[model samples]
Target: MNLPNKLTLMRVLLIPVFLVFFLIPGIPCHYLLAMIVFIAASITDALDGHLARKHNLVTNFGKFLDPLADKVLVMTALACFVDNQMIGVIPFLIIMMREFMVSGLRLVAANSGTVIAAGFWGKLKTAFTMVTIIAILVYLSFSGDFNSFSLACADTIDRVCGWILTGLVWISAGLTVISGWIYLRGYWKFIDPEA
Candidate 1:
């Protein structure tokens, strides 16, 4: 496999490691570890793309799998966080639904001989979503009754983080919907009009 593909596979592999850190009980530094792993995986996502484009190493397989890998990582993290009650159900559902809708649109565009690359808004949405998730995870990691820290301070921080996450989620959702609509409109003629 090429370097970019290798990096993509590495990212996919990190998902389980991220889960292990995020889900394991009684681990003193679970949240910290999870955040580190998540950040590392995110970095790989960027590195692979840069390398692919810089070195002319982009492959059909890389194009197909890179975004899939990102979706899987983000979705899995969001699902796990929701299951653990670290994040709310509504945001999780919105993110999940957007992913599915976009994936469907991508498939339709692919069949029509159009490669719908990730646009600026889509990239911004992903970056903001990742930042929000990371912030939430960090808050969760530190907010428990693990020490003698001021409860009020922790609560305030938690609330701030929650608001930030919620705002980012909504913003990302809006961008996702807009981008998906734009893509669908671009490819509307490709759809089987008779069907």
Candidate 2:
């Protein structure tokens, strides 16, 4: 395996550690630690792609696994937040639906020897989603008890972070939908029933 591929694998490997820190209770500054791991994983995402393109080390394995690793990592974070009642299900569902649609489209295109690279909107969505998740982690870390902070500071932190998080989630979802549409529009030929 090349260096880029190794970084991709490292991102996947960090997911379990992220889960442990985010989900397990009683760990000191658990949210902060989880955020750090997540940041590390996110950095690998950028670094691997840059190195792959720069060094011509891109491989079929890297191509296949990189996106899968990204989706899994993001989904894990969103699902954890949803389960912990930090965010609602609507944005998660929206983002997830977009991903499923895009993935299905990719499968169809791949069947015909086509490869669709991610669009600008997709990249934007990813950036926003990562920032949003990080924001939530920061909020939780400082709020005292990830699950029960709202009860403690229901009037102040809860209201402020809630609004900010909600805005970020919706913006990410919007970008996700737009990106999915861009894919569908650009590749309609592959999935056109009346073609």
Candidate 3:
């Protein structure tokens, strides 16, 4: 395998490690560790693509596995967030469906000897969604029991955090929907029998 493909596989390998950190409650600073692992995996995703494109090492395997790795990592992280009540189910569903649909379409295109690379909208959607997830993780990592604070102060901070999370979720959801539509619409010929 090429370097880029190796990097992509490394990302897939890291997911279970991140999961262990995220799901294990007794581990000290587990959320922070999870965030760090997640960020590392995200870095690998970017690095692999850059290396593949720059060195003319892009292959069918890389094209197929890279996006799959991305979806697996991001979706797993989002699922972790949902389980912890850091995000709502509706927004998660929206994002998850987009990933799955795009992935499915990509697979179909690949089978037809076409490579459906990511567009601007899809890249932006990924950026926003990753940032939102990371931000939520950071917040949850450092947060303390609000009950220990003065009620008024706790209420104020709670409202502020709520607004931040809500804003992030909505913005990410919007990007997800727009990107998903653009991808499917752009490649309708491959997706639609009548096209």
Q: Rate the local accuracy (lDDT) of all candidates.
A: 0.82, 0.90, 0.88
User: For model 2, which pairs clash?
Assistant: none
Against the true structure, candidate 3 has what lDDT? 0.88
lDDT of 1 by residue, 1-195 (tens): 999999999999999999998888677778888889999999999999999999999999998999999999999888887897767787678778878877887888788788888887679878888887787777766664244345768667667777877777677667767766776676666675865
RMSD of each: 2.1, 2.2, 2.2
Which pairs of residues collide in candidate 3?
none
Taking all chains together, each candidate's TM-score versus the true structure is 0.89, 0.94, 0.92
The candidate that achieves the highest lDDT relative to the unseen native structure: 2
Across 128-147, the per-residue lDDT of candidate 3 in tens digits comes to 88899888777777663213
Global lDDT of model 1: 0.82
- Model 2 residue 51 lDDT? 100
Stretches of candidate 1 above 4 Å error?
Answer: 145-149, 192-195
lDDT of 2 by residue, 1-195 (tens): 999999999999999999999988788888989999999999999999999999999899998999999999999999999999998999899888888888889989989999888778888889889999999898888785445564756777678878988898888888888888898999999999999
TM-score of 3: 0.92
Find the 10 residues in a row with the least total lDDT in model 3.
143-152
Model 1 error, position 107 (Å): 1.6
| lDDT preference between candidates 2 and 3, better one | 2
